[model samples]
Target: MAYPQELINEVLDYLDSGHSVREAERRFGVGHESAARWRRLRDGNLRANRPHPVKYPQDTVRLALGLAYGGHGFGLDEVAVMVGVSAPTISNWKRRYVEGGHMDIPEIDLGEIKHLSPDGRARMTDEELEEYIHKLELKAAVLEGTVKVLKAEGIDDLSNDEKAAIVDALPAGFTVTEALPEVGLSSSSYYYCKAKPERPDRYGRARAAIREEFALVGGKRGYRYIRQRLREREDPIVVSGKTVRRLMAEEGCRVSYAKKRRSYSSYAGEISAAPDNLVARDFHAEAPNEKWLTDITQFSIPAGKVYLSPVIDCFDGMPVAWSIGESPNAELANSMLEEACGQLADGEHPVCHSDRGCHYRWPGWIGICAERGIVRSMSRKGCSPDNSACEGFFGRLKNEFFYDRDWEGVTTEDFIGQLEQYMRYYRDERIKESLGWMSPMQYRKSLGLAA
Candidate 1:
């Protein structure tokens, strides 16, 4: 099967994160051979995962150098890494300073002292050079300690411009070269970064629009939804989800996940009135309405708690009918059942299944089943797995919609409307792996099962 570039990229993300190609295929529900072909993934920059080299601030280098010179056991090459300079350059600098009191850097022939004599002080007797180098190294260690303390006290996650500003703000004793190494920037990057104006965020316009949309949705919409909204605007501006996510993260605008509430069950010890488990956990259906699962889940709103009962068809995991009310009563299930049964074609006898709830066992529900010629199947007492298909629908519903928002200040009526709308979206928009990434309605329509 052909997969979209986005889907393939998702698989690549999994692969890049230390997962094997087989694992990526299984995780993203892609084909085995597709993921195994490594060459295809590397062809496009966006399709494959690329390495991001590490970047550091210049002041940080000073801290590393100070530690090494203070007998931290770091070699000259290691010190160079800490300061973002070449190992040879670090060694040369140390030697030149040691041998000539910081003046020998230009005077001495650079190649003559490639071999080290410990400290690099000039013209001093070996004895003097040794004592002076020790003093200097100890001082560097002290400087590193001070730099660490200051960095910890400063703003974390500094922007590039802020880092440059910090370097520019350094005290008189610290030179630009010392600060440059700490930030881990080459002279070119430093100059380019310094020249750019810092007044506006590069993504300022997009960030503003994203923040507005996020606030409108009660800060509950995720990056995908926000990106969709941006694309659907009247004067649609092009943008990517990565930008939205980054902006949201920078602004501390995040959607909080709400835990799902335990579902209410009316499972009593098997009674004579309850029907047999006819479906027997056989959720697979040969055609539409062959197996139907129904269940009720409650939602808490400021106005009051609301209950939703839906009859989901097993063939395509679509909701045939649903009913919502403020009260979790027998009427809610009965109304839902009536609507679902009405959806069946003439002479169709769907096996309507439900948990051993009082609503399903009640005479009202039983009478409807008998009148409509619908076959009734009940789950074993307290065995949710028996009617797992219906439970799965409820789990997905709550996870995607009801469990991720603040219902506070939302009236029972408005909440019910949105809940109903979400169910419609779930059936018509949300894609499923089993359905080949098609929504329930889309899957059914694709097979000419419905218009």
Candidate 2:
């Protein structure tokens, strides 16, 4: 027997026009219960001949109900302010009207409410979801591998996303097996692919063993030399040249090489008669006046051809006396020797040694050494090793200092200063293992000699 608000209003209006309740009910299609309520309202209004009191303003009630229907979830305080009513009054009205199931009489139309369809709620297909999951897993794996490689290479700042991108860009079939040696990773991880007997179970352990041996021998031997030594002792394991090279590079191994040059004069006559071990003792003395070793070496300095006649002391290894001029004549050599002798201490008679250079063999230098009471020692002709100490020093000086230097910005004076500084550092600081692993100065101090 329920009736819509429209039907009730229609029956009530009909009754106001003096129609009976039964007639109004029949015309408006209202049930008996609804007709009874309309009859009561009509009779009461007729007796008073006055309009019925409005329950709420049409616009206010419509707005309140519209907000509720729109799912705004506004509280009574908020709704009351918008509808121009007290919060308590709105609360009571909401309880009496809405909670009590009173019919809503909306005066104006509210826009349509939107609800999602099944298709809209479920956008992604099973296939698409599976593809996304697969991509995520692949990306995660790629990032993990990239991080491993980067860490091995000592590059720690790479971002996770960048690492993932790098992993993705790797060759399609690339694996950690390919990266092992290049990135210096553990060998066990790499062995899963090749599983060759040649592959060492632990690369780091093998490398450590090789390095310890290399350190013990003082790097005087190359990889082949060390390998031969190891083989002679019946060590079954074999290492490749490339692996040794990489290890040597990592360990900062020192290497020596003779400068390459086209053959000029073989000095066959002098080589045939050259004596051995005539100049084995290394000499250095304190102050400029002490023990002197004189030698002549050729140079192509920018100022035409020049011969350097340097008289170095055997004590502190300082070039106390030097002369640079056009030709290495006996006069030039004698003059340098005389200059070094003049600077010597009182009663100090140093032994002057040299190869059979034409200047040293001449009577001028010979007479000077004899008059100065200096013991003259000569190496047999063409035997560079007979003057090994001086030759080795010159070779190192040229290769490590002079040969590598840029002469473009240097004047003669600048060159001299630079050479002086180099000699100072070489004597006082640079450690020479050949000199019992101490600097020349340190060696002198160890022997209780003044440096």
Candidate 3:
């Protein structure tokens, strides 16, 4: 059934040894047809040696016969593997053999099968495949040129459905260069098909532009003033204060108060009465309310000159009591001292330190301190450092609170109310860098002091 190389060689050797076909078939697994084919090859070679006219070589015929015999019942793939050719080439040879009834050797030139039609001739000549490809290339170039011209004229705005219809209408397997240009597109149009749409209006562009203009003019005017100015001029857009504030932020503009000259004096006479460490040596205190510092500072509120006297503890710098009145007399200062004394424990003689202002010079004030066992300490006259704690407190109050506001609009009552809130916040919440960045209440708690 199957003739291996070894079997074919064995059959040939048996024939060469003068063995009969029947004997060779019995010795080798090869059939009688294989023995007859091998003998035909040997006889054809011997005839070629006589050299009358060797038109076709015996080896060529032998190769063809071998391929045909191997491909007898085998598939093209199997025949290709056996003969060392591609499966398609094997298929072509098999097709030629079936149609022409002979091996389609290169030496046999069958004068162009002209009886067949053009399509049939195409099927016959393998070289004709190149001509077909060249024609396709030419058609693609023409279509590509047409698309470029149409795109240049802006007449190629076809919808996706229309474009797809155009594409599907073309011949199948047509190159992109050929197909795209017919619809007035470049080869790149196939890839970048969709056009970019128009951009929509920016929502806050008008407001943003107005804000930028306001900032460019300098944001010294209030939002209401600016709005009034714009309206009086009959501007295109009306804007609210909130919108102006938003615009101001966008334009990096800030409205700040202008600084004024210091209007109050820190003069306090009669400081020669007290000795240096006897009445005012150590400023340190271990806990809140242990020692207190007091001073009078003046502020110009809308209600006219208001005197603010605040009592602060030396230990944690906590404000114990404060009062704002029209005068810096002894009554106002004593009232604030009395309120501060109320915070002290019974029989507690907390040292009270202050500059010898006219308030501390009054007998009623001294009597109150004497009754409360409060040691009254006066600072050296004209030396602010002697009462530096109170001076520092006043500086912070002005820097952080008073200077940032339009003071011309603030009343005494409003200032007092805001001061109360600030005092509470400062004592209970605000962290002090001196107290390890902890609040006064927190520092007191850490030192085991009662509220």
Candidate whose lDDT is highest = 1
Q: How many backbone clashes does candidate 2 have?
A: 6
Please tell me which predicted candidate would have the highest TM-score against the true structure.
Answer: 1
Error of 1 at 423 (Å): 5.0
The candidate with the higher lDDT, 1 or 2, is: 1
lDDT of each: 0.72, 0.58, 0.63
TM-score of 3: 0.41
The better candidate by TM-score, 2 or 3, is 3
lDDT of 1 by residue, 209-307 (tens): 888888876675577677767766786645655667788899888887666657565554555577789998889998998888998888876788889
Task: Compose the digit string of candidate 3's lDDT tens values, residues 401-428.
Answer: 6665576777777877877777777778
Worst 10 residues of 3 by lDDT: 107-116
- Candidate 1 ranges with C-alpha deviation above 4 Å: 1-172, 181-184, 195-209, 212-219, 228-244, 251-253, 272-287, 315-317, 370-451
Off by over 4 Å in 2: 1-292, 312-321, 325-327, 342-348, 435-438, 445-448
- Which model is ahead, 1 or 3, in terms of TM-score? 1
Give the clashing pairs for model 2. 283-314, 284-314, 284-315, 285-314, 285-315, 289-344
Question: How do the candidates rank by TM-score, highest first?
Answer: 1, 3, 2
For all predicted structures, in order, the TM-scores are 0.57, 0.39, 0.41
